[model samples]
Target: MFLTPYVERLPYPSRTVQRAIGVAAVVTQAGIGVTGSVVRVTGSGLGCSTWPQCQPGSMVPVDHAQYQTVTQWIEFGNRLLTFVLFVAAVAAVLAAWRIVLDHPSRRRLVKLAWTLPGGIVLQAVVGGMTVLAKLEWWTVAIHFLVSTPLVWLAVLLLRAFNEGDEPPRPVVPPLARKLLVPLVVLMWLVLAAGTTVSGAGPHGGDPGTHRFQAPIETLAQIHGGLLVAYLVVLATFGLALMRGPVPAEVWRRYGAVWAVALAQGLLGSVQYALGVPEVLVALHVLGSALVIIATAALWCGSRDRGAPVSGTPAPRESGELTPAR
Candidate 1:
């Protein structure tokens, strides 16, 4: 009885609301990665000096001689973003659940929606481990690497909201489609190498943090080589696309991927040349998130999933509403 009135007054969420939730899910997922980089580059990785708490005695940041107030807040702020991401994830799950309850045929969306919240939980555990481990290079690398797949899933969730649950049909030619497999794998490789370079480079999140054992120069060369290989594969995929007619949307997405990759490459070059300045390090991390988003968009756009199915009826001019199931 206590909750009945609130439940009765709640309006059914429209398709537009669901799609907006999807978009929010994607943006928040990507935004958190950039913030994590900020924590690292600012030497605030251990700003709170403990996980699940700012310090041993406090959950919130406190004035401490051992840590600067600004640095403690920076790290605590990043931790707080996990809750924002969780909120987006919960909204996505609720939206998908409502749709599936009304139209069972759209049940597949629920699975994708669930992954967002699950991934956020996993990220939280890894983040805590990174702090507990004293910001070890590999733990930090793992923390950053986890975002790639979460970002990929977020993009897929957004695409699902805009399209049907039907099986994907490729719009690109067979060669072009097949080439994307390698292209995607190479993208992950480049990301891993980039993280490795960060591990060995100057920024270790803390002044006394342990770095990877390899020489920074050697790691940089390896990361650069992988990037060059990824570019060649992308160029080859473009040529394959040229062999046959392709959808305009596919071309646009492909161009976006190319544009992001090229700009990221340029930024990486400048970052390296400038001795990995703190500001550029943050920008480079943001660029990495963009590259993930752009490539995921390209992959999703390469396939056709037909039109979206609406769970709720068209809105009445008088704005009378049905309660969500």
Candidate 2:
């Protein structure tokens, strides 16, 4: 609701300035996520063997044959993404601060914009700890989880910047306690399980890089099984969409989620069943992040009520669906 108002009042730039900034932020964050996966894949979590700086004397090593050059790049690349994330966070904070002072609708957007930097700061500290602590699994998991909410905020900011001013909806529908909510929840669960599977595997980021141990295939199998359950729920939801008075936007989201889940499942099977090469594994991680972003976007965009029903007709709703003041 706070964001809704700011979205209405915020001024638009002629050159898609706001959208560009938002997109940059998302891209940077995604880059960070990918770099993280690389760190895990290459067992380079401790390449630097220290944080805030790779080592006491040098930022980038000049001579090192023990650690492959490619491995050095992967770990350093993750660090570089951190810098980019910080810059994006600053730009967003400034933009939100500007909007909050004058516009009522924008106040919340501004507030949320500020939140990203704070989270990043904490993330940076936690990241250092992960390195210092030698890549603890719980720390790693927390670090990974923290990124999602920031990404969610980034997505919200981008959407708000693009949305034009309009009077507040007369009525907002109550969200249904339906299967969709649980389904999304289950998706997250499966993802968490995947982290466990990853941690137990030899390839799970550097054990000293983090707290996790070698990934056990038995655990990986359980994680995979959960993924299958996730697919079943998604399919059931798809069928329900066919029967229920779901909105077009909602339908589109459903399709997108299902598509990502399907792709992720296939990639997972390939990565694990085929002996788990670094390349397939990296794609698997990227695919997971993509699914998370898309899922968050879909969840935000959906509503229990709005618009004209295509054929069968929506139940009478007398709120935002009608004309506003």
Candidate 3:
């Protein structure tokens, strides 16, 4: 109870500040995943030779005979990015807490905000496991897979900033909305298949790391087939939306997803044909992050959550509370 007065006296964050923080959270979350791919393709996964520490009794990279200096720094740099991600997540939580609203909206925003930091902590632990496991294929795959949902949730949190606490109503037709379920499932499957292909491919993060015991050609074919299915479903969903009364915003978001998916497919094909070069591998990871972000935005756009609650107070230039629009 002693902290109540101080908490109330805290300056409220503007809506612009809140949305900016949300965007930062989404970007950092996705960027970290891309950087991780760099670590893998560069064979720097064990540059630190340990977890939560760069080496024995050292929290930073040190001269080691077993790993290249560049590789050590690359891995350490990726590890440092977790701190940046955590900072963004904490900022998101604080910004959400400062938004003035009705009890329900306030509570919901706060709850969603907490997920950002919470997921980062979870990812940190999983990351440590990935390192300690000697860059095992499944562990690496798990680390990447975990980021997908976090990216999705980050987008939802961003959407929540401009919306009320009301239950979501479909902006598209009911059937079109229903089709999204299959589309989303296919997206997940495609990601999983892609990871499986990665496990079987040449890039295992380290020369000593065990590759998944499967023919790379077979895995690639499976992954490609899943991608084809996802594209087909997504095209069908787009057609359904076009045949009905949908908002322009929804159409724009869906179009972005479609464009990103096609680009990603083309990149995947080129990466495969070129023998999965390191640069293209990093680009492919970036494309994967884009796919997740675009898909999540489209999903959010398909739902209508009304407007922000009225009469909520925001901080003014004089440091006094004034009603927000």
TM agreement with the true structure for every prediction:
0.93, 0.78, 0.93
TM-score, predicted candidate 2 vs. hidden true structure: 0.78
Error of 2 at 15 (Å): 7.3
Clashing pairs in model 1, backbone N/Cα/C closer than 3 A:
none
Candidate 1 least-lDDT 10 residues: 1-10
lDDT of 1 by residue, 22-68 (tens): 88998999899889888988999999999898999999899898899
lDDT of 2: 0.67
Q: Report per-prediction Cα RMSD to one decimal.
A: 3.1, 8.5, 3.1
What digit string (tens of lDDT, one per residue) describes model 3 on residues 1-325?
A: 3533444555656678778988988899899999999999999999889989899989988888877889999999999999999999887776665563323356677888899889989999999999999989999999999988888888888888878878888889887898888888989999999998999889989989998998989998988999899898888888898778999999899889989999999999999999999999999988988998999898889988788762256324784543332
Flag regions of model 2 displaced more than 4 Å. 1-15, 60-70, 164-177, 207-215, 304-325
Instruction: Quote model 1's TM-score.
Output: 0.93
Candidate 3 contains a number of clashing pairs equal to 0
- For model 1, what is the alpha-carbon lDDT of residue 135? 95
* After superposition, candidate 1 runs with Cα above 4 Å error: 1-10, 314-325
The lDDT of model 1 is 0.87
- As for candidate 3, its clashing pairs are none
